[model samples]
Target: MTTTTDSPRWFKSSYSNNGGNCIEVAANIPGAVPVRDSKNPHGPALVFPADEWSSFVSAVRAGEFGNL
Candidate 1:
């Protein structure tokens, strides 16, 4: 696991309407993207490689998941 001394700057999409099933992502971290539940800010975060995260976001934006 990658560890960093810097704190994560969490961000949630504006499209989220306070829905209970929303996730917050921290893009400020270098080389990694940390994601956690918006409802549970104190909970554990799942970190992914920055490149992988970018690809996943691109796929979502391109509707690869279909009606997600």
Candidate 2:
């Protein structure tokens, strides 16, 4: 697990409207997608397999979470 201190490039959704509840993701990391709260840049991040993250995003676009 790499730390965010390495300065992994993080980006939030362009649709994010400066809300305090958003999250940021660093997809540049090889083999992983690191996700952290946008409000807490220095906080611990949850790293997910890139493929899994893609699947999750797809599900979200597909409305799997339903009204979330």
Candidate 3:
């Protein structure tokens, strides 16, 4: 896990309107990108490499995840 002295600053997409199904992401951390369920702010977060997270976002923008 990436340790930090400060808590993550999580945020969701402006397009998110799926009620409790939305996920939040915190990319302000120095070395990692963290993601978690928007409905469960206090729950565990999934951490990923910044590059990997960027790739995933690009793929999502490109519709590579299909109808997601």
Candidate 4:
């Protein structure tokens, strides 16, 4: 998992609202991205490579998950 040693400021998804079923992400973590469930801050974080994470974000922003 990525660490604060990389010094990334995690941000909750802007689409996150009162539902409380959202996720948070830390970007630019050198070679990886760290993501965690917003409701479980102390839980294990899932790590992804930078390029893969960017593609996921792009897919999300493009509404690829909307119909699914």
TM for every model, in the order presented, reads 0.88, 0.88, 0.85, 0.75
In candidate 1, what residue range of length 10 has the lowest lDDT sum? Answer: 1-10
lDDT of 3 at 47: 93
Clashes of each: 0, 0, 0, 0
Model 3 C-alpha lDDT per residue in residues 1-68, reported as the tens digit of each score: 76472578889999998777999998789878989998888888999989999999999999998998
- Ranked candidates, highest lDDT first: 1, 2, 3, 4
| Clashing residue pairs, backbone N/CA/C < 3 A, model 3 | none
- Lowest-sum lDDT 10-residue window in model 3: 1-10
Q: Tell me the lDDT of candidate 2.
A: 0.88
Q: How do the residues 1-68 of candidate 1 rate in per-residue lDDT, one tens digit apiece?
A: 55472578898998998868999999888899999999999989999999999999999999999999
Clashing pairs in 1: none
Candidate number achieving the greatest lDDT relative to the actual structure? 1
Candidate 3 C-alpha error for residue 32, in Å: 0.8
Q: What are the per-model C-alpha RMSD values against the true structure?
A: 3.4, 3.3, 3.2, 3.5
**Model 3, global lDDT:** 0.86
CA error at residue 12 for candidate 2, angstroms: 0.6
Badly placed stretches (over 4 Å) of model 3 are 1-5
Model 4 steric clash total = 0
